[model samples]
Target: MLVAGSASPAEAGTGQLLVHLRSLLPGLAGALRQVANVILEDPAWASRATIVELAERSGTSPATVTRFCRTLGVAGYTELRVGIATEIGRADQAGWEVGIGADVLPTDPIDRVLRTLLAVDVQAMHETAAALDLSAVDAVADAVVAARRVDFYAAGGSAAVLEDQQLRMYRIGIATWTWADVHNGLTSAALLGPGDVAIALSHSGRTTETVEMLAEARRHGATTVAITNFSTSPIADVADHLLGTSVRETAFRAGAMSARHSQFLVLDLLYLAVAQRTHERSTEAFARTADAVAAHRTPYEPRARGGSARSADPQRGA
Candidate 1:
């Protein structure tokens, strides 16, 4: 009872694909598009489809239905089912929702940190795969490389990410700056010129202060980039290009855990890529940075040896 080609990829559910059925339905040489519609409309039944069950539903042959699933990126109907379920599983778990259930307590320290890390990692992978636009990423990278200056800013928990990135870019000799305070962030943005770039980091992508800085940066004719979650959010709208991480977070979990992890990963990718592009400058900068740090070092005894030196001796310095 469904028309074909009416659904677009934009409207497709996470697990349920939208197929163009009108083109191949009872036309000059059509067979499977009709079947695809039947499948697309009710992904659950289609997921469990047998060739005969599917053939009867779409008025197509068993072989035709088998061909349809393969045509639509599945190995066969069985894969189509399991794949859809997996996608649905992902959809169900995305976003920030805290559980209020009775505390399930495990006192193992190592297990706790590992579990949290694993959860964040899983979320990061999902968010990245779901939201990453390769073309947009390439465009952002090209713009960063081509820019004369790049400024980045963050606040609250996201500040850690910007601090780390600031160090990395400083090492590679990119003309980069990071601001955690609002005063400096805005000041930095206000000074931007043409061919300059600004990057804003936020997990929720809706921080008023961060967005204001980004807005100001844009006014100065600099291109803006956002590393954030939620594509339809404010940061994504303001950015010239967006990069996202897929960490589903809840309120009760550790603060700043997932967001910090995602931001670091993105910055690392950009840092290494920029380094490769300007290998000579990066190498010199890295060596210079290392030398400067090494020059400031103070030799120190081991903690145990220092403690022994200060041991409470009854005879004072006789």
Candidate 2:
């Protein structure tokens, strides 16, 4: 299994504890899931509750609770407690109000909805940054910069994210292509070779088409990267590098909607890294691309101070 930043439970900071729990929920089941639900439902209570109290609350034995802590990569119940408490304290210090995770009600004020959405999205980015492995990111960036070409595969909402990356890469003169169609993705994957790179995007890391495309690319000798929310997800298994995001679903924003900001955070990091690695080339490409589109923009006139506006010569400058 992939460890967050390769940190052992003891070394893992308390800030990411809640984020990890949320990401791991989909993969958990049975008594383990029960323990997780109880803690998640009221983590402030869990922080102060005794091991026995937690077990009783979850309707599980102490032994099961121990197993749950182990699954979270913590040493024991005490460590888990400290982590939860510290995370809560940090959130409080940040002035995050309680009920930020509440579902958006139809009757809620627009400002309330705005606050809730911004809060969750910002939190997701923070969690993703905290848990992301810099080594993995650098490795993927190097691979992307050196690759002969790159292929991106995604379906549904993830496709929009891939398209954004593809455009950015293209602007920097990278040979990049994105596919939302499974057949086209597979075809591109089949043509990939040792110098090629393939990236698949999936929120749950369980999208069959995305997984298959990455698997196919890997089989064809391409370096495969998976950006997903869960490390244990199937897509992670096939990837040469895994970048996980942390996103919690509210009733109004589920799956890709909740995951978009987190996913964009990861992609933006990778893109910037690649651009930095090829700074001179990237700079020229960016300038060239900008100039190519300059004529398409509407011309503007600058107003003189307390006087008439001066028109810009569209052919010369705008």
What are the per-model C-alpha RMSD values against the true structure?
Answer: 10.8, 3.4
- Residues 1-318, model 2: lDDT tens digits: 344334434555877788778777777899999999999899999999999999999999999999998988888999999998887887777765543255678998999888888777777787788878789899999999999999999999899999999999999989999999999999999999998999999998899999999999999999999998887778878998888898878887786798888898999999999999999999999999999999999887776566545333335433
Whole-model lDDT values for every prediction: 0.65, 0.86
Best of the candidates, TM-score: 2
When summed lDDT is taken over every stretch of 10 residues in candidate 2, the lowest stretch is: 1-10
Clashes of 1: 3
Task: Mark the regions of model 1 whose C-alpha exceeds 4 Å error after superposition.
Answer: 1-84, 88-113, 126-131, 254-256, 298-318
Candidate 1 overall Cα lDDT vs. reference?
0.65
Candidate 2 at 317: error in angstroms? 25
Tens digits of per-residue lDDT, candidate 1, 174-266, equal: 788888888999999999978999999987777888888988899899998887754445676678777765454444454245556666767
Alpha carbon deviation, residue 125, candidate 1 (Å):
3.6
Q: Give all TM-scores, in the order shown.
A: 0.62, 0.92
- Candidate with maximal lDDT: 2
Clashes of each: 3, 0
